[model samples]
Target: MTITATRSTELDQHRELNADETAVKSVRARIAEAGVEYVYYQIVTLTGRVVGKVVPARHLPRNIEHGIQAHPGVVADLQVDGSGAMLAGSPERGECVVLPDLDSFGVLPWDTRTGFFFCRMYEPDHAPGDDGGRPVPIDARGNLRRVHAGFTARTGLEMRSGIEPEVTWEVPGLSTEHVPGTPHTMYHLEHMERLRPVYQKVIEYGRALGLDMIEGNCEDPGQLELNWMFDHADRTADRLILHRQICRRVAREAGATVSFMPKPADDRFGNGCHHNISLWDGERNVFVDPDVPGLHLTQTGKDALGGILTHAAASTAVMGPTVNSYKRYLHTGQFAPLEINWGMDNKTCAVRMPANGRLEIKSPDSMVNPYLSHAVLLAAVEDGLTQGIDPGLPRTTGTGVPSPFGSLPLTLKDALDLFAVDQAVARGLGSELADLFLRLKTREWERFCASVTDWERRMYGAEGC
Candidate 1:
């Protein structure tokens, strides 16, 4: 008797793409047209960092077929645990293959000779058992793609989102200090003028790289929130990653440093990347209630909101991934959401209806990993939809009335504890990714707890003691 190996879902998808000779030819033609000499095969890490190899354009076809091999540890950013053991896997672990999504090919506007493609990782074909050519479980970007696809197939609803990326640029002459008699710089035209060159370069690169430049304004002395049009959740995540890359390049050119830190200082406004999301069923918006006047949500929308609120605390581990990220929540009156409630156009609520059909989640800070954030959100929303979770009444006032859904976690440690127990949120990231994310973040929290800050010295040193 003859036996054959079973094909994994990832291997099936990979095999299906192998037949797309037209797409391969089109990418090659575009590269030739642009006079591109080098191409980057980039993969997003667990922490949302982009890492990959650059190859000469001539090898594009060979690369597309064979793909690139990299250590699986790259997905974890190659981070180590408390004992200095690799958090992802051992050095002896077999390499994974990164295959490009040809549709994502784009040439760098700054460096016309070079182009790049966002890739998905899979276990190498030579891997043992059914794992061969399977999607790497820790591949956050790939996971989001599969998650969204599954959600849409099950519910016939697509999640569309736009991210308001607020970044602080440390320029030579810019100051965050408040002048005693002068008005605040929020939305001030003069402050924007000062950084015109920087924003202009950023917007230019963003548009060239496929972002539909919508609007932007100076939010604080050195903080700016530039926005682009909303799109499918997966595309929006990719755009957010590209936006960060663009800002980094523009900052280098302008001799300024860009900070995506949630809270750079106690007094300064926290840098937030608010996700404005809506659910769509074909051409119709499922979140909008056409029969009701003023601000109202459809049953589907409310259920989704309820699901998100229920899981918000647990999901915070991904939204606010660092120790400093929690500081944004502790700082009072900084526009960061403290409660799990949702209200009409309420900035103080974690989930708020910024528009008739959209909900803006403010808990996600600038440092969030979009892939992980969206995955958790999709899972939570699906739970709400399937279980018919009720969101209850919306809070009309900004007062600290306790939400039945509870408060957002005040620290990374607390958030991780919640994340560890919430199987629903963990399901969104899959078991493998959830475990790795928890390990990496837990290590981060431990490191922060062990280290003494300047505040500690000020409170306990000889001067105070």
Candidate 2:
């Protein structure tokens, strides 16, 4: 069934269940064949964390017909403000329904008896007026799908992306200590070999769950980056979420702890989730300029880049959500982009054209919410295409050099301020999501401001004594 803005989600649910009997039967057959006993109906939250309910495989048909219900505040991670009030909504707001996407069904490789499905959220049927069973506006995953569909319908172009997620692992025999004169372990073969068992299991599970594992390596002392082939923006986002889950399971089995934190230490290199993006028109890459020389972009690519640069600051609040996320930007010579500019093969620029036909956005950290990030990017690109925005020449100077376009937002507060004013970003996230996101992040910023840190205590404790 086609989902449109005008169509009620209740009607869509009814049509999908009534017409997709064959698909349901197929899933049942697969479940029996795989001996699956339990199923997880997973939902992605506003912060990209996974939250949901699990049901027995025997209840698949019943659950699909009537989705599982949970408090809508899960979208905000059930967070509370300084006054101890629920951030998402009041308790009387009732629960939301989570319906699984049939196409996302897959058996867990770690436990063959268990399977999972990514779900879309909807308001409960007993809601006031016609709001019943309506799509949840604050649902990040659902919002991305809707936004992408609208973008494709309007522009006849598709955005494909691959994310390079860097994670730090705390494992046995892996030391963060660096000898004074010895070479560091970044990309070293010995370090990669030490983490072979960990990466091997991760890749195996990833492949079983439909990730086309391509390559991986050990960067820094305990950091690793394993990548898969890029696909449609929505699929990429789903895979990223799955990848994190797989990493967690692997870490549990290996007696290690994995961290997706952007900056784990003051002296260490920050973890970045750089997005390699391209615009496609059917089989052709619209960003490519085959007639031009090396590392050239088409006019379409330039405009898209302009939009990204134009909205880079506003998007950073989603890309780097945590308080520690801004710490990644404080260090120089760390590959993190400090300036809001594009460059050809320059790793220090916020947006870099590493090769033709794609741009790599360096602003996103390991903790980014891909759903929100991609949605904002789509809006920025759409505005660029519509307005014919032009990104100026690429930067060729060294790191710390200022660009004509100014620097990236240094703090979450700064980014939030920009996000508050940027209509394109607000429109991208939709009004409801934008408002919810702003509220959550603003509370986070305020909490951080109210707390005292070790640095502050160390400096101020002895001052004027």
Candidate 3:
């Protein structure tokens, strides 16, 4: 399996290519067998994967370049963090393989111009391994399963989740963030007009990706949301990963860069990856008890909420994992809550009891690996349950914004450091996973840290000199 050129023919170079080709062929055959006509997939280094279905069209016939692409990395403005920082120097650009995920094949109920494979970025020669192989570290699906099984075993409760994404999309080069030529409110109609074809393409893409998605417009103009049907926590997280990719791709073909940047523009509002998660003790809601006086939430439910809040600061790394993530929590001296307080009907708190039974957190944004983020989040909830933590009556003594509850980290480095100190993170995620994450994130942070900022240079050139 070790196939360096310096190595033996036991590791044939041609064999790897053949193996990858076979894998691709096998998957393509599976899609055919499944009666699927379109397929799509995306590849990114870390993890979070889903495959989408697309309808093949005469015009968009299989792209001549049908693989994970690399063309000298010449797109000079490639921003790694999506935070507007640019990387310099041409990194070695090589072809990364993108094989379709046949397991994700499905026929589109709508338009059929494109099909998709939830693609995998694989080593060219890497064949599908033994029937079962160790998971890639970034695989949120695997990570969530590991944690989900652990939590259910201990509490006899499993979680189910659904999402309501609040997003705004426009044709490319129309960004208010980078270019501020027009009123933000007026851009939606134009966005919608251009988005029509993209919407049809999305329907085609969703089927290939195996997403049970339904799309709709939201209260905002270009504002749109896609509802991914409910699934167990582990699986739902995986779908979100794929969902993000699908939405972006369809948007791009229609000439838009789908952004999940927490706050793309300072003057405008940011988006929230609102999670509606509930625990089920074998299909029955655990938090559903209509009565008040110590009966509103089962002790188990309260424990989970308490664990999340008490450890809220520590969990900030996962919940609000990026610098931009904190931007949504504006501290403009208004009623908006940047702190960690929770209450029913209180959007003011980090954790809000939206209604009678459901608990919601607006802290997490789309940039997160939904599965990994969910796992860490669940771990926090699990910790509270185990410790029998009490959320203590939601500051219900009739309070004014429940006294600000500090805030999440302002930068990736800050979040990484906070995660390092969280004992619950270590306990829930396991040392190997936690340590590996720290090391990886630290490297990413250093990369950002060492880079020279255009802002710093422009602002300080003459003054500093």
Candidates sorted by lDDT, best first: 1, 2, 3
Candidate 1 per-residue lDDT, tens place, 228-292, comes to 99999999999999999999999999999999999998778999899988999998999997889
Q: Candidate 2 residues 1-465, lDDT tens each?
A: 987776456536643763497888788888998999999999988888999988999998877777788887999999988798888877878888788888788999999899998888887777888888788899999899999999999999999999899999999877876675789888899888888889999999999999999998877888999999999999999999999999999999999999999999987889999999999999789999678888799999889888888888888898898889999988888899888998899887899989888999999999999999999999999998988888888888755556666787889999899899999999899999999999999998999999999988877888625
TM-score of 3: 0.68
The estimated TM-scores of all candidates read 0.97, 0.95, 0.68
RMSD to true structure for each model, in Å: 1.6, 3.2, 9.0
In candidate 1, list every pair of residues with a backbone clash. Answer: none
Q: Which ten residues in a row have the lowest lDDT in candidate 1?
A: 6-15
- Per-residue lDDT of 86-165 in model 3, one digit per residue for the tens? 23213453433343343443333343433454443323334244311223333334456668888899889898877766
Error of 3 at 223 (Å): 4.2
Tell me the whole-model lDDT of each prediction, alpha carbons only: 0.90, 0.89, 0.58
- Global lDDT for candidate 1? 0.90
Clashes of 3: 26
